[model samples]
Target: MRGLKDKVAIITGGIGDLGYATAKRLFEEGCKVALFDLKQSDAGLAKAIDALYIQVDISNEEAVKLACERVENELGPAQVLVNTAATFIFKGVDATEEDWQKINSVNIVGTSFVTRYTVPQMIKKGGGSIINFSSVSGFVGQRNFATYNATKFAIRGLTKCWAYDLAEHGIRVNTLCPGYIYTSAFVNSCKVLNLDIEEENKRASEMHLLNRQGQPEEVAAAAAFLASDDSSFITGSDLLVDGGYLAK
Candidate 1:
């Protein structure tokens, strides 16, 4: 994990559950994290790490470009890029077009923007790693999550194609697909579905082969590997850190 030492990383959505955990892990590995999140995200993770953080929504292209410029000016070219910022939707076809556009913009389009801005820097720096945050829903399917599933699935497609495109530039592109994990989002989802929080937690645990819901740190560990030399030979692979959910 410490192989990430001396590297600079630009981690999107770097203040929330998964993002915060990843940032902590990267910091522990001796990497400097330039976090791009919303206005609130800066506050959420400020006390946790001493790093450069910018407030910008993922769906805004100009905002992201500005954020990248600032990141490059403030912290050197990013040697590692982790596109973890995403908006989750749990609605089915009944989901409104506006909502669909919003989620798709952030989860898919915004991911592209971050990649667009960061890749050149990686190339100039002699290549690097790009790890995307996809989900199990992309591999299989999930109910009442059509909008979300679309974006996650699109992320995998992006990963696959980018792996080949960036390979010549010496950049590795891979996707990290996680199953259901315990987070504020999950807790809110349980409430929205009218299920008892504790009950749903137990249910999620049983759904996984490990009989437990994964923590953010679990996925963060995988990100560390993909970002470091440990996974130098890994590209275009969907690494499932889902506690065996897909195995079942």
Candidate 2:
């Protein structure tokens, strides 16, 4: 919690769900934040954080460049980076190239690009933290989610590599693997499928050791620690924010 006061952070995909939660948590800890998400999220979150809204599709190079430029011009190089924006299609290996590319672009390539631009800034700032979002699904096999599973698994490896490479520069990298949470988008998805929303969610909670799905704020707490000195000695770690889903 100490030393986070007035620190700057860039949270890619920050205008929604987990990102928004983490951003709010960090902000509460007295850090300055810059949020990036689909340009569509600008109006909604800009008011919430009272921070600049960056219309960045992390998968697009030009968009990322422009967003980071704006951050530097307006605030400063971020001392923390959280890559939370992700998308995927659920299907078998019969999944098309487009499906693979879409997930890969946002989940893998986009995460890499954000870290690529921001790591140097952290180094310049004399060290910082990066928290990436992975999933318990990545650690285990899942049905009907080929593309997403692959990217999540890929992120686990990327977290370790970045930690190794960035450690010497004082930049710590780690991943937060969340199992399931109640988010509006997910609720809408389940509803669209006409799934018994309440029962399905209850089943999901039962699957976890804690007998409940996690809240975004809970995951955000872990992220907040990693970003602050509370985790000074930690890096190259995958902190499972899952409510015991992987244990089962």
Candidate 3:
């Protein structure tokens, strides 16, 4: 919680449930927040928190570069960067090259690009925190989830390497690995799959030791800790906000 006030923070995929929740928490903590996403958000959502919202495809390197620059110009050089932008594509060995390309472009490459540009600003500020979102999927196998799982695993790997690379400049890089969280995306996916919502919810809840899916705010709290000086001693580590799912 310390070292957050008036700090510039960027949350990629900011319009989404998790990202938006994190942004709101950071804003409440007195940080200047910026939301970057491919989709346009309700103006009121950003206005409600007095945060900047930019619609940009993180997968596009040039676009990401410009967007980071805009954040610097508008919100000041970001002292915190949360790479929450991701694309989900579930498939096993049957996954095609196109599926790999689509998911990898956004999940792996886009996350790297955003961090690439943001690191300089952080270095300029003499230090920063970078929270890369991984998942329980990153640490274990899942049925027909090779495409998505692979990228999640890669995020953990990247965070460790970046932690080492950035340490000299006082930057900390760590992975936030959360279990299934009850989000709008979960609801939408259930609708698309034509699954019974309550049944699916029950199924997901059973997967966690806590007997329920995690909430966006819960994950946001973990992220806030990582973004704040409270986690100053942690870096190159995977903080499991997984509701003991991995333990079970």
Candidate 4:
């Protein structure tokens, strides 16, 4: 996309399937990329792509602040920030305090910390885009998804508020709400549970009007658009890369 060349972009959950895919796309568009994750990457994936990888626990404000500083010093100020790191804790009304803490720490507070630190870098660069990963669950309820869904919903709310607060600084904030995407984690979970992979996939496929899971690259494409000047006028919006899941 236009205006992405030589820009710096940071993606959280960088080693994950979707996050890595987005990093690759942005790199191909000529952007310097940084991957921030809680876990260390064993494969040297970021090095392979010539991107910077930082192990960071975004829930800790100080760690996030330092990490952002390092990125600025290394890759220059970030012009695009994608907050894809999240903790999935599925629970219902019976959720315990511990469950709430675990989910909120990473999904909500952690996201906030990263954004709080990165916004200044963006402002220094004159403008930027922030993509917060929400989910279809954020819009609709599902069984035993109260804890996770609550945080996702909060993400959308946060995006809108940030958009309003950052507009004057030329920052754009939006939520990326995706449906079930066929990812390595899905296949691995099926194996761990001894579930038939094809059968489980079929069950998930039925949830979307497309009759199949979305791909990581497809979502990455939308992310690139939001990060680029292509989405210059878009902000405080939910870009549904859900394959018509909510249309049904």
TM-score of each: 0.95, 0.97, 0.99, 0.98
lDDT computed for candidate 1: 0.88
By TM-score, how accurate is candidate 1? 0.95
**Which 10 consecutive residues of model 4 have the lowest summed lDDT?**
42-51
TM-score order, best first, reads 3, 4, 2, 1
**lDDT of each residue in 70-125, candidate 4, tens digit only:** 99999899989999999888899999999999899999999999999889999998
Candidate 2 residues lying further than 4 Å off, grouped into runs, are: 42-44
Poorest 10 consecutive residues of model 3 by lDDT? 48-57
| Cα lDDT of model 1 by residue, 153-212, tens digit | 999999999999999999999999988889998898788889899988998899899998
Candidate lDDT scores, in order, read 0.88, 0.86, 0.96, 0.95
Question: Which RMSD does model 1 reach against the true structure?
Answer: 1.5
Better of 2 and 4 by TM-score: 4
Q: State which candidate has the highest lDDT.
A: 3
Q: Write the per-residue lDDT of candidate 2 for residues 1-248, one digit (tens) a residue.
A: 87788889898878778989999898889888999888477476667776777877899887787788788779888899999999857777798989888989999998888888887778778999999999897798888877788899999999999899988999989899998888877788888989988888898889789998888899899999999999999999999988888887
